[model samples]
Target: MRTALSMTLSSFGANRVDFASRIHEALSRVQRGDIDVVLSDLSLSHPFDGLRLLEELKTRNLLKQSAVFMIVTAEANAQTVLSAAELAPDDYLLKPFSGETLRQRLVKAVAKKQAFKVVDQAILQHDYLRALAECNARIEERDPYVIDFMRLKARLSLLTGAFLEARQTYEQVLRIRPAPWARMGLGKSLFRLKDYPNARRVFESVLAENPYAMEAYDGLAGCLEAQEDLLSAQEVLSRAAARSPAIIQRQRQLGELAQRNADWPVAVDAFRNTIEYARYSFQHDAGDYAQLSQSLLASGETQSAEQTLAQVRRAFHTPQSDLLAHVMEYGIASARGDAVRAGKSLQAAREQFAELKDNLPGTYSVALAEACYRAGDEQAGKEVVSSLLRNQHDDVAVLRKVEQMFVAVGRESEGKALIEDHANDVVELNNAAVRMAQAGDLEGAVHHFLSALAERPGSMPVALNAISAVLAYVGQHGWHDAYMQLAQDLLARVGAQDPTNGKYQKMMQAYRMVRQQFGIKGA
Candidate 1:
């Protein structure tokens, strides 16, 4: 394929063509020089494939608007094809194509890339509204890539939180042609709007047409889970995992679902796969070890559970991991009726938690709370759960997990009451700030949220509200350097927490607008 591509490019009077047989070599070459075109095969010998290469290029911001990326792959499987398409390659060429065919495809792909240059620029700047407008204008021009622009418009609408517009755009595209991507986009829009039944139907329809559509399976599973059909969701995810076991998020989702269903063996296997698949990926986490150990203990495998904790201690030599290891040890010891060992493990865990509580990830709180309760430290347990609730007041999933933890410890009613209390507190605090802002007290509102953030340091809602208030102040009162810095810092924290969050993306767009309005050089 490489030889053919080189010959084709040479035939087209291209001055230079570079080739790399491995993912690392390709990445290194791209990093070291300016490359105008990249043609990669779907199946690479390394665990990282062509899709991963494309991902790395985007992550490193190496793929310029003028440069084209085309996938040259013989693999015709739906999983590979859809995955490649999702990354939005310039074009995909199947094997056994002629030199002339390659030239034609390359020319067309380059033209498309050139046409979308402005739209790409807007997107890279996090200006989705501008990009959406560009896409809309292009669609009105009846260009050759009208469908592509329509697709982009739908995607940008989703990013901008215009779910109804996204749904409408996707449906319009589907009316023209039943593209799988369009169908998936429509399902996503419906999901965002909380129309789970219709979303489930759309995803199911996609799977019926293309059984290997892994994303369709995921969407269907999510809809099922949203409708509280855990068994069906588990079944759907299990089928998807059987077909493609390399996706870490899918494996992790399956593990959590199975754990929720009390299918400890399935949870163990899924989490084991998640750990293995994520070993070299950024998705790897110490929480996976904790989850695997919990599943193992639930399945009456205390020795294996202990071994997993030991692995966590070795793999991650951080305070958080040490705390996690000790917490798991306490569980294992308690399970084996070793009261003395359990007490010692609990004491060590408490020491580590004392040092790390202010900045701990909320994921570890449940286990720590459970351990505290088992050790007869009800005050400590309540404190941990309360802090978690304060930080994650609006996260339904985390709240559900907290409720489950409470149920496991036989304090379900207390959990419910505590959750309600914390939720109300956060809501009332947020409302007070909103009222202050509405009463022409933007500065007061900003200060209010900042104080709330001090009390709930890891609270995403609080941080986002603080950012909003700060930006509003800056927008109305001119750019206050301190206020702008506060907004940026809060944004950084929110991005570190979850970059894909729609609210974070919106705040980023707003921040950029503010900077641009003020002639800020660094925006």
Candidate 2:
């Protein structure tokens, strides 16, 4: 698939094509935004395949944007094609084709992609309204690719937060063919509308017919999580990760869920695999190393835990990773009754974080807080939790972590009070902003929303509402670079919180529109 395709493309005046031999290298390039188009094959070295690569791209939402991806399979197996629908590849080329056929297919794919530049550009700028209009215009003109435009319209509606319209569009597509991607889109819309029971059934049916669908597993897991069936959620993720170990994101979640279940053995293995697999991708997080060492300590393997900590210190050298390693070492020493070392490490972290209030990522801050609490500086730990809560008042995961950290320090009452008070404060702030907007004081509304965001950076609801007000003001007034940047920062924070958030898709659309209005590139 590599050497031969290169030769074929070269025959057609292709200037350059990187033939990647390692899965990790190719995935790293994709994550780094180095590849604008990807042509992959079904089979590869063990534990790696084109589908897994496509799954990662889809999860990152790269497939829908500027990049063009095509998968070459040896045979057009019904299930393989059906499962591949989830990623919505540009085109699939069956094997045993002549050079002319391959050339023609490539030519057609490239042409369609070029023609899609306008729609793609608008989406890149987050102007889903413009994108939707362009798509409708194309459809009304009865373009030969009208079916394709219909699918694009549905996706645009979904991105625009037009849930009902998205649902209708999906249904319209499904009538022509029962594609898993379309059906899954319907399920997603249902999930967004909070119709869990129906969403669950649709996801189940998707997996039933196309068991290899990665998004189906994610959707089913979402359904389980919403129901608060942590055990089932863990099992669902466990099964999915087992089949697709290359999915390091799922592996990380499995580790978290395992810890919550007190399944230390599973947590240890999951963290270990996450650390190992992350070495192969550009998606490394120092937080996983901490999780591994802590899980080892939880399982009563102090020596092994310390060894793991030493390895982490050697493997990653970023400031955050350094802090993470120190925290883990302190955690290990505290577990072993080495008070002196624990206290020293706690002081080191405190000194590093002394000047900055909201400098570190939430996960890193929480890790430091845990280590500090264990090292006997309960106040420092509580303060970190307070900072995190102020930003992410509605993040259930952060809230749970806050509860756990505070309860460990014998400050459960204070933690609960802090949570309630800050959550209500954010709500009041947003309510006041809404009132301002209603009273035709859009500028005041934007001001209060910005202040609310300053107090609580991780609140997606607040960020979304703030973004709405800013975009409205921009539409009525004019584009200001300051407001655009504020909206951009909030979107970045939202992404830092959870890129997979359903609302995240909608917010990015608005963010693009703001950037477009400001005549700015998305970079």
Candidate 3:
């Protein structure tokens, strides 16, 4: 009852009009700061309609603990109600409704928002652990909309790498309502846990509900990709892109699929669109320019390819930016039928890399090897690849690159033999570590992992799992200080190298648990 009075007072203090003006200003302010509520007329202008506004807000962010967004419509109908419900506004009211409905909605919204206030703030600040804790606290609150609360918390858990907690919340949400998002969340958790079949099943269920759900399609494609089903992954990306042409990410996904299959033209087009969309947003990436240049060269548009390379070299002046610049310049020189110039340029690149002196992994060596081979120095190219293999002996991608370099230099048999030797070494070393782990000699297993890493520091799987096993063993040791030190080191290494490695993430989660249990700093 006093809300109108409070609104009037607040409006005077803030130099606003009436309650409606205050609400409008508040809703507009949502983008600037975290809005706790929204009040708008359902029947507004084209893009300013209440439903459209709510949809935009939902897509930008889900609900926060203290976010109490509502819709006030002129008239309620099946269509309007369904739309509002689908967006899951905190409260919905028919226009010409009494103050009672507004008050009721406000009170309910405020209560729900307060319940989630801590979590919302934490998540907004990217403190996912706090969000998960808050959500877990409200998992069984006596509210009809607790399911939404639980789902929100589960999402935070997933972001925080609390996969087990996220999986539990997802299951709970599914039991209450088979929401497509919840199903997708479960699939995502299963994927994180490496349960591909279950993840595929969950993604399929999401598709059954909404066949054009791009997220589900992407997730399904990821499942296929993990299983090495490139054809199926390509098909999935193709279908998703066809279904949602407006999704720039889907286009980029298709581009990646095309590039993986060596479809240069498709890759170029898709990456071009991706770069276009990225120019104005947070998705912008310098690598896109380099990739576009590579694709252009692959398509035999040598002049256009050189132009693309020039753009990247001129536009980005950072240290690592020169890597792609050098790579593309070498390619362009070789394409122009000037092996002599190409050789000189590649030699300069090699000298530059040597001056840097192992600051990065053997990436420069591999790239340079390819350039030298293309420039007709077959023996020099072979030596370059051999040096790289010596540094990163167990990295499959690096090994593949080396093999390609050898084949380009007319040394296919040498390349095959080299790869086979490394493969045999990896298999034996990995098998020994596995046996050590199974035999409960975790300390010995950890030593083996360290040794394997010394042998091939760039092997993502071997290095990541090695760190994971160490963290897991540390968790069992009750050595909180040692655990924290090792955990932070692993996190730094992962951040430096393969940040996307799932096992590295598992170690991160284990680290978090140890930190939480021991009340360690940076938890």
Candidate 4:
């Protein structure tokens, strides 16, 4: 295939073509030079494939706006195709194609890439509103790729949290043609709008047309989960995982859903797969080991659970991991009715928790709280959970998990009261700052939010509010470098934590516009 591609390109008067047989070599080559095209096969050496290469390029931002990536593979199964599509490859060519056919596909791919160059540039800059405007302008011009622009416009709308516009754009595309991607987009838009029943129907329709659509399955599962249909959601995710088992996030979600349903065996298998697959991906976390051990314990495999905890101690050397291992050990010891071991583990966990409480993730803190409750340290448990709530006051998922933990320990009412109190405190703090900003005391608002951030360093809402206050001050007063830098730092933190957040995207767009307005260069 390489020889054929080279010959075809050479025959077509190509300027130059570089080839690499391995993923690392390919990445190195791309890093060394500006390449216009990347051609890869789906299957490469074990554990390294075309998809991995694409992912690496994307992660490093190696692919320029106009660079075209084409995957030439003999594998045409639904899983392989959907997997490649998830990465949004420019083109997928099956093997045994003629030289002329390859040339045509390459021409079309390059053309499409060129057509969306402006929109892609804006998107690369995180100026999603500009990108959406570009898409709309291009669509109005009636370009040859109008459908592509329409699709992109719908996606940009979704990214900007313009769910109504996204729904309308997707509906327009579906009226033109019942494309599965458009249907999926429509479903996602509906889901965002909290129209779960309609979203479910749309996703179901997509699956009816193409049962192997992995994204459709995911969308359907999300809709079901939103409607509190845990069993149905778990089943949908199970089927999706069976089809595309390489997706670590899907496996992790499946495991969590199964764990929620108390399907210990399935949870064990899914978490095990998550751990294994995560080893090769960026989604790896020490929490995966903790989850697996919990599942093992629930399944009456205390020995395996202990081994899993031991593996965590070996696999990760962070304080968080140490704390997690001790917590899991306490659970294991309690399951075995070893009072002495349980007490020792609980003591170790408490010490670790005390040392790392300020920096620990909410999930780990929750685990520590549960261990504390089991050890009859109700005060310690309450204190840990309260701190976690303050840091993550706006995170509904974490709050739900904390409530569940309390309920498991027969403290549901107490948990509710604690959650409500913390939530109201955070709300009042935020509202006070917002009132300052509304009253034209922008500096005061910024200072208030900064103080809040110092107190609750891990609060996403506080971070976002601080950024807004800083930006508002900059916009109204002038470009204060310290305030701008502070906003940028907060944005970097938020981006690192949740890059896909719509609010973050909007904030980024606002940040860029502020810089541009102030004639700030080289940001």
Alpha carbon lDDT of each predicted model: 0.82, 0.75, 0.65, 0.82
The residue pairs in collision within model 3 are: 65-113, 65-116, 66-113
Q: Tell me the tens digit of each residue's lDDT in model 3 across 1-523.
A: 3476457435434243224332234344665654556665554322235554555554445345577777766643523333313344566777566655667667777876676665666655344555555666666554555786787776656655668887988888778776666777888899888899999988887777666455688889989978878778888887765654434566677776777688888789888877765554344556677668778888989999888887777777764557546766778887888777666667667766655434544545666666667666777666666556645675665675566557556778978886677668778877898898788887888888877777555556666667777776776776646645665775777655644344555566666777777676664
Off by over 4 Å in 4: 1-65, 76-88, 98-100, 512-522
lDDT of 4 by residue, 278-375 (tens): 77454568889988998999999999998898888888898888888888998999999999999998889888877787789788999889889878
For model 3 the local lDDT of residue 175 reads: 85
Clashing pairs in 4: none
Question: Model 1, poorest ten-residue lDDT window?
Answer: 78-87
Q: TM-scores, in order shown?
A: 0.86, 0.81, 0.62, 0.87
Q: In model 3, what lDDT does residue 398 have?
A: 64
lDDT of 4 at 388: 92
TM-score of 4: 0.87
> When superposed on Cα atoms, how far off is each prediction in RMSD?
3.6, 4.6, 8.3, 3.7
lDDT of 1 at 165: 97
Query: Compared with the true structure, what per-residue lDDT tens digits does model 1 show for residues 1-523?
Result: 5686677788888888888875667878887876778888775323456666786776555566567888777776724455423346777788877888888988888877787887766665555666777888989999788998898788767766789999999899989986778888899999989999999999898888777666788889999988989989999999988877767788899999998899998999999998987776656688899899989999999999988988888788888888888898898998899999999998998888777776787778888998898788999999989988888888777887888888888899999999999989988998999899999999999999988889889898899999999999999998798889888899988876765467878898899889999998665
Go through the candidates in order and give the clash count of each.
0, 4, 3, 0
Using lDDT, give the best candidate's number: 1
